[model samples]
Target: MKEQLVFATNNPHKIEEIRRQLGDRYTFRSLQDIGCTEDIPETETTLEGNARLKARHVKSNYGQDCFSEDSGLEVAALGNAPGVDTAHYAGPQRDAEENNTKLLSELGDRKDRLARFRTVICLIQGDTETLFEGVCEGRIATSPVGHGGFGYDPVFVPTEGDGRTFAQMKQDEKVRISHRGRAIAKLQEYLKSRSGADRPTG
Candidate 1:
């Protein structure tokens, strides 16, 4: 039987991405699956802190071994203005379109479009906590491109890919190079090692 693992998130996009990446090895459950309806606190000022906060909340309240991730788009020209505030950059509504518009408006006519997407994952199992981080360097597009992804995907073009924005790429294509993907890869490695170590002697 696959080891059951909880992912502490209510966002379907995040849940889908993580499930696609790690579903083969483990049984995945979301916050709703465990009946966590309250909005978990995310008052952390840093990506890692926020991720840790969510993971700890689930583990403490639900007594489940779970993981949580926080992602942000940091634009160099903006001095990473929305590093920790990526979700609510425009306002507290967390509207992606509004956030994108605000980002573009603030970045109008700027030549420097260098940016990066960063993801931090915090995993809690029993009393042990582990963190993993991944970064994808890229540039912010002047306008939204495709509609394949959520949040900043429509305006983010990864350095590892062609000029197309993340939203223009297929799900598998994007996942292979996304910051979240890289972090998930590291998590899979760690989970594999843990599984191996927990196995009984032959």
Candidate 2:
């Protein structure tokens, strides 16, 4: 496995989660550790595009093996209103509470609360990029349920689970099937098959 890999993100929660999943087998560093706090425009129209855009930017800027992810909460009733713009759904200045509230408001009067959390992770080394995707199907609860996870976790009740919101599940429990977890699993498989020092690959 690569000794050190960069994840192009600034969210500590996300970094912690990924580290917990990947563990000491590989060191996971973020934008701050690599001195890349500059704004990278997410001008892409799809999750895969945004993820690759971030990963490519980090690879070019830091000249290292970098990975990035773009995730979104898409509600079937809302016509996927917050797809790629999930982070900024509430407006230019995004707030989790605002975004969640807006989602609930828009979903009002709709009996079908179908929704899915989609995540796309892009692993990049120079011009080579590999994509892994995961989706968790669930329904939006009438109101927030727990205080554990972040973002829309409080309202997302997984279809395969015991009706508990993701925020209500323990970190380990959530990591078992969360979109990020699945993506990380795929990445681990790739790394295990190609274990080596961090050298430039043509």
Candidate 3:
């Protein structure tokens, strides 16, 4: 039987991305899958804190092993103003387009387009907690470039890529170097080690 783990999120995009990266090694259950309908509060001021907060909430409330991640786009010109508030950068509505627009507007005509996407993941299991972090150095585009990725993907270009926004790249391509992908990779490594140790040896 596959190990069942809960992912503390209802966003289909994030779920899909993570599932693709991790493959079939383990079964994942989203917040909705576990019948959690309440809007979980992310009152923390940092990405790592928010990830831990969500994971803890799910583990405590539902009595399940779970993991949660929080990602943000930190721009140099803006002094990383929208670090923790990446989702609701524009308003409380959490509109991606509005957030992108506000980001561009605030960074108007600024030569320094340096930015980076950061992801922090928190995993909770059986009284043990672990955290993993990933970062993708890049720059913000002058305008939205593609229609593929969610959130700031359309406006952010990875430094190692061919100058295309993440939204413009294929799913597999993006996952290989994305902030979430890197963080998930670390989590995957840790889980694999744990699974191996838990197995009965001959």
Which candidate achieves the best lDDT against the true structure? 3
Tens-digit lDDT track for model 1 on 35-128? 9999987899999999999998988888888999999999998999799999999999999999999999999999999999999999998889
> Per-residue lDDT tens digits of candidate 3, residues 111-198?
8999999999999988999999999999999999999989999999999999999999999999999999999999999999998999
Task: By lDDT, rank the candidates, best first.
Answer: 3, 1, 2
Candidate 2 per-residue lDDT, tens place, 60-141, comes to: 8789789999999989988886999998899878788888898888888689999999999999866789999988889999
Q: What lDDT would candidate 2 get against the real structure?
A: 0.89
Q: Stretches of candidate 1 above 4 Å error?
A: none
Which sequence of candidate numbers ranks them by TM-score, best first? 3, 1, 2
Give candidate 2's error at residue 184 in angstroms. Answer: 0.8
TM-score of 3: 0.98
Q: lDDT of all predictions, in order shown?
A: 0.93, 0.89, 0.94
Clashes of 3: 0
My TM-score estimates for the predictions, one after another, are: 0.97, 0.93, 0.98
